[model samples]
Target: MKRTPFGAWPCSIARAVDLLGDWWTPLVLREAVFGVRRFEEFQRHLGIGRNVLAQRLNRLVDEGLMDRVPYQDRPLRHEYVLTDKGRDFFPVLAAIIAWGDTWLSDDEGAPVVLRHRTCGHETRAVVACAECGDPLRIEDMEALAGPGLRTAGTAGTARTAGTAEGEPTAAAADSP
Candidate 1:
């Protein structure tokens, strides 16, 4: 069956999910973030199928998140390195790790912990406002209508869920 492409969705969350929703992609990214630059190292650490790993690496390179740089000239071996775009994704992975550590960890506790290099202290991931440095919470946020919202025949206005006449708001999914 063909998967629905959420990349074209109007929502940023949907677009992000479309790109990073796959099981292996995030793990591959995690490996990269951990400084796995060579193909052999990634394969050895992940134990992923060669073809699948190749595909993920290629996609990441094509997306400008990684650069495929030739490291050896004799056999033309190339190593993957994260671009600025790829490095920026580390925060997202940290947030995921934090959530898993909180809600899904075993009794042994989190398999890993993040320690700040500068402060020399363990820290938990938290999404904060760029300008204010305050933690972002759902209750303290509002989703305003953006320029990308479809508004051809209607006046430009933000509509809360259940407030839009004749429009249906999505019901919560039973499982994540």
Candidate 2:
């Protein structure tokens, strides 16, 4: 069997792992999205070492996913704030939570359910067809390479066409 270097693959998922791929990274993002912004907060919440937390925060800031803001002047204290790029990850987090709840949870349902403010009911994250409002299925998609995707293959190409472009293509329409 042929083997490929894990990092050598030109895929978005692989690239994402290279950047935010640490086992601790997603937990850090999870805390950040849930309003834990301070270095101390992250350390406390995740029980991560101060050094590791600092490194992750610095990396996130360098990637433009987070920004450091001074919250206290006397001690030169700062807090991390999510940038638009970081804020945009809410859907990704929601999908992850939904999956874990479905597949990993015991008899309990989702640990925390999302309730839409407009409608008084629980909501599951849905990516639907804009034109016909139909729910999207894994088969209902394709991927077309962009500049970033020039080198990515299977892993880099998880961005489904219908989801990325918000329109069903001929291939998507062919799904039974």
Q: Pick the candidate with the highest lDDT.
A: 1
Name model 1 segments beyond 4 Å from true. 150-176
Q: Number of clashing residue pairs in every model?
A: 0, 3
Which regions of candidate 2 deviate over 4 angstroms? 1-10, 130-132, 147-176
- What are the RMSD figures for all models against the true structure? 6.3, 6.4
Residue range 9-122, candidate 2, lDDT tens digits: 556677567777678888899899889988888999999998888899998999888999999999899999999989987887888888888898888667878777798898
**What is the C-alpha lDDT profile of model 1 across 50-168, one tens digit per residue?**
99999999999998889999999999999999999999999999999999999999999999899999999999899999999998876455456776765433344544343445553
* Model 1's TM-score against the true structure: 0.85
**TM-score per candidate, in order?**
0.85, 0.74
For model 1, the local distance difference test gives 0.84
